[model samples]
Target: MLLSIIYVIGITAEAMTGALSAGRKNMDWFGVMLVASATAIGGGSVRDIILGNYPLTWVQHPEFLLITCVAGIFTTWVAKWVVKFKGVFIRLDALGLAAFSIIGCQKGISMGLHPGICIVAAIITGVFGGLLRDLICRQAPLVLHQELYASVSLVVAGLYLGLLHFGVSDVIATVSTLIIGYLLRMASVRFKWRLPTFTLNMEGSVH
Candidate 1:
């Protein structure tokens, strides 16, 4: 029940962000809905495909799709507020990422997969929605960079899985993962922390 609520919140936040991107591009309502739905559910689709899980979430639960579409249209009406309060959205987005990771980790556990594979699923679920939105809007893939986007997912999934491994209660494990993952994301954003970049000269030779 708690996870379900988090999932809905996560998708709604992602859909709103996606709608803002579409609005910036001056897209029509249909385009807004498209980008919104893609941003909200694209990650889960990719995860299900990778795992060979049939009947995607939106397919099985069409109301979730409706929620994203509604969120997109709703965002169009409140674009100004969304922009003015993007920081709040960022925090929501961070929470959403944590939720996405937890959901993906749970999916992997349901599938009886290995811990490493679960971590990968969590990262994919947490990262791919923004990737899809960027691709649709002709923007660069933001989450693919060396920033902590993927790292947060990794740590969240690992910690969640680790806790469960040691027989932690589901509620405690989920809540702890969510809080820690959110803090890590906010800290990274506040501090501009990123993985060290590697650079090479045009004439640099491979070892």
Candidate 2:
């Protein structure tokens, strides 16, 4: 129940962000919906495809797809507010990333996957939606280039699994993971923390 609630909120927030990106590109309503839905659920869809999970989440629960579309359209009406308080949006995005990571981890655990595989699943779920959105919107991929995004997913998944191994209750493990993951992401943003990045330029020498 707790995970379900977070999943819904996560996708809604993701859809809204995707809609904002579409707005920046001056896309029409259909384009907004496409980008928004892709941003909201693309990660899980890709995960299922890779994991060979039958009947995708949106396919099994079409209502989730409807929710993403509605949320995307709804964002258009409040784009100004969303832009004005971009900090809040960032916080929500952090929460969404945490929730998505936890959910993906849980799915892998349920399938009796290895801990390492679970961590990979979590990172994929947490990062791929925004990745798809950026690719579609012609923007640099934030997860690839920006602050500690995929690392947060890795941390959350490993922590959750470790907690479970130590005999923590599911609810407690989940809640603890969410809180810590969110804080980690926000701190990365506040402190401009990032993984080392490699750069190449015309004037730079390379091996």
Candidate 3:
């Protein structure tokens, strides 16, 4: 129940941020809702598909879809305020990322998946929504280039698994992962921490 509540909050925040992205592009209302829904649910959908978990969240609970659409329209009205409080959204996104990773890891564990596959599930849940949003908006995918985005997902998933391995209660593990993951994400953003980029120069001598 706690996880479900947090998931709702996560998707709401993600949808609002996605709406802001749509507003930046001067999209129509339909476009706003489309992007918002995609950003809010795309990751979970991908995770479920990969895990062969039928009846995705939005499919099972249509209200969640409604929530994202409403959040998107709400953001359109408060677009300026949303921009002004971008820092708050960043924090919310970080929290959401942690929650998503934990949820994904839990799903994989429930399915008796390998630890590595669980970590990959976490990464998918934490990263792909933003990827979809950026693709729809024609912006560069932030997960590919941003500060420790996917890395944070991996770390949080590993930490959650480690805590479980040590016999920690689920509640404790979830809370600890959330706190640490959020802090790590914020710190990465503040310090401009980034993964090394791989650039291939085909400039002079490739046949």
Candidate 4:
């Protein structure tokens, strides 16, 4: 139940940020809602599809979809305020990322997946929504270039699994992962910590 509540909050925060992105592009209301829904639920949908889990979350709980749509529209009305408080959104996004990672790890464990696969699930849940959002908005995917975003997800998932392996209670493991993950994400943002980039320098190679 706690995880479910956090998941709702995470999706809602993600949807609001997605709406801001849509507003930046001057999208219509439909576009805002579309992007919002994609950013809010695309990751979980992708995870379920990859795992062959039937009856997706939004399909099972239409109300969650409705919440995203409503949150998107609500963001439109508070565009200026949202922009003004962008830092708050960043913090919320970090928290949401941690929550999503924990939830994804839990799901993978429940499915008896390998630990590495569970980490991948966490990465998908934490990162793919933003990827979908950027794709829909025609913006560069932040997860590919941002500061420790996907890395944080990987660490959180691995830590959660490790805690379970060592006999930690589920609740304690989850809370610990969430706190550590959130702090790592925020610190990365603050410190501009980033993975090394790969660049190709080809000179007149194409015919």
The most accurate candidate by lDDT is 3
TM-score of each: 0.94, 0.95, 0.96, 0.96
Instruction: Write one digit per residue (lDDT tens) for candidate 3, span 1-207.
Output: 777888999999999999988998999999999999999999999999989999997999999999999999999988889889989889999999999999999989999999999999999999999999999999999899989999999999999999999999999999999999999999999999999999998889868
Q: Provide the overall lDDT of each model, using Cα atoms, as 2-decimal numbers.
A: 0.93, 0.93, 0.94, 0.92
Off by over 4 Å in 2: 204-207
Those runs of model 4 whose alpha carbons end farther than 4 Å from true positions after fitting are 204-207
Candidate 2's error at 200, in angstroms? 2.4
Question: How do the residues 139-177 of candidate 2 rate in per-residue lDDT, one tens digit apiece?
Answer: 999788888999999999999999999999999999999
TM-score-sorted candidate list, best first: 4, 3, 2, 1
What is the Cα-based lDDT of residue 53 in candidate 4?
Answer: 80
RMSD (Cα, Å) for all candidates, in order, is 2.3, 1.7, 1.2, 1.2
Clashes by residue pair, model 3:
none
